[model samples]
Target: MIERRMNPHEGRSVINNGVKLRGSGFCIHMFYIRPVTYRGRIDKGQKIGEMLPMQRVYPGITSHVHVQNCNRFNVTRYL
Candidate 1:
């Protein structure tokens, strides 16, 4: 899997529970989840689909993640 943050200066960490992506201004995070193939047999344990925004992923968590041009986020333990 490959995770790329548009802004590398942002602070991020991954705890036991989930991944943490943080940034002050506009931040773009890209996640790449790959399938494990063995002997021509592919294994995709979880359902893969379009990636949703943080708000959609964690409903009721934050009504608004960004305020104007300033954006701050630290999502923890959401795996």
Candidate 2:
């Protein structure tokens, strides 16, 4: 499941989106992006969302997506 919401942690206008993968042992929250998938079973490599235009929001700032694990553990080992 994916839901769109404002995330003050990112910024006053930044969006904090959520993607819940049930039975997969983890969930992910995507910051600075807009969700394309609201609710459904998504496969690997499927398009779930797109990065927001941060350049317009924060001029001269780096444009990137912030992916965080809801489990509060480092996922670098899995990568």
Candidate 3:
């Protein structure tokens, strides 16, 4: 599942984009990056999207991606 919704934490127009890899039991949430892969099987090392320049969205914040190893069934536990 790919999430493209308003960030609840930010409480603004900021979108929280991310990909939930159910098969692999993990999810990758990205900030300041545009997602290109919408619906399909993503292979390893596949180009999911282009990384946006951090200066535009978050000034002074380091450019990086947030990854979480989660339980596919539970959806809350980070294991």
Candidate 4:
């Protein structure tokens, strides 16, 4: 798949995520599930999905993640 990421600096880059999309230009991100909560507690996989944010949180810092999705999509991963 053709995916683009527009950084805060107004810079953009395209990448291939192995999805089948031809000539489709758009921005994208690869999201996944973790086994913990924002407060650093282990959470059950079955119940964690209900608490994750539906929107993308771009944490500029690499030390920790602080983004929260406002919607309850019950999604475990996204890209």
Candidate 5:
């Protein structure tokens, strides 16, 4: 099932998803989509670089966070 953009621009760019991000002290719009393949749609979970997966696409007003803790004590133990 190939998902074509309603209004594709600059190739894969579609309409602004109502989300705005400020980068380098400037506001910019963002859009994500999957590419059509020779047979049909792309892989299910395979990410093609910076493009976001449709199944895991994030919307505005949503909050996401991640925390990583390195608790490797005695590194030589596993060596």
Candidate 6:
């Protein structure tokens, strides 16, 4: 669904499930939704592009760190 900002200065945005997004302003967050199933265990999951946002105020340079680790289960047992 497309969402319009109340103030035009802020700019408008569009969001849809499992779809990429684009807009005029800086993208602080970008992600995707997907279903994960492992060993008959199923769950809804989100894939985030950026785990943290970094911006330089003086130079007006903005950037984001894209997370690459996709490991969901790392079990440890002690007996």
TM-score of each prediction = 0.15, 0.64, 0.51, 0.16, 0.20, 0.16
**Which candidate number has the best lDDT?**
2
- Of models 4 and 5, which has the larger TM-score? 5
Model 5, runs deviating above 4 Å: 7-30, 33-39, 48-79
What is candidate 3's lDDT per residue for 1-79, written digit by digit as tens?
5543212135443334545443454554444445676556767687766655555467887766655444324546545
For 1-79, candidate 2 gives per-residue lDDT tens digits of 4533435265355544435444355676666666676666767787877877777767998878877766768977899
**What is model 1's C-alpha RMSD?**
13.4
Weakest 10 consecutive residues, lDDT, candidate 1? 33-42
* Candidate 1: pairs in clash: 17-77, 18-77, 18-78
lDDT: which is higher, 1 or 4? 1
Candidate 5: pairs in clash: none
As for candidate 4, its clashing pairs are 1-19, 53-69, 54-69
Candidate that scores best on TM-score: 2
Q: Using alpha carbons, what is the TM-score of model 1?
A: 0.15
Residue pairs in candidate 3 whose N, alpha carbon or C atoms collide under 3 angstroms: none
* lDDT per residue as tens, model 5, 1-79: 2222222234433331222223343333234423232123345574422443344434553332211112323445535
lDDT of 2 at 69: 68
Q: Sorted on TM-score, highest at the top, how do the candidates line up?
A: 2, 3, 5, 6, 4, 1
Q: Candidate 3: list runs displaced more than 4 Å.
A: 1-15, 24-32, 72-79
Model 2, which residues run further than 4 Å from truth? 1-23, 76-79
Model 2: lDDT of residue 12: 53
lDDT, residue 37, candidate 4: 30
User: Per-residue CA lDDT of candidate 6, range 1-79, in tens?
Assistant: 1121111112222211122222354221222222121112212353322222233222454443231112322324411
RMSD of each: 13.4, 3.2, 5.1, 14.3, 16.9, 14.7
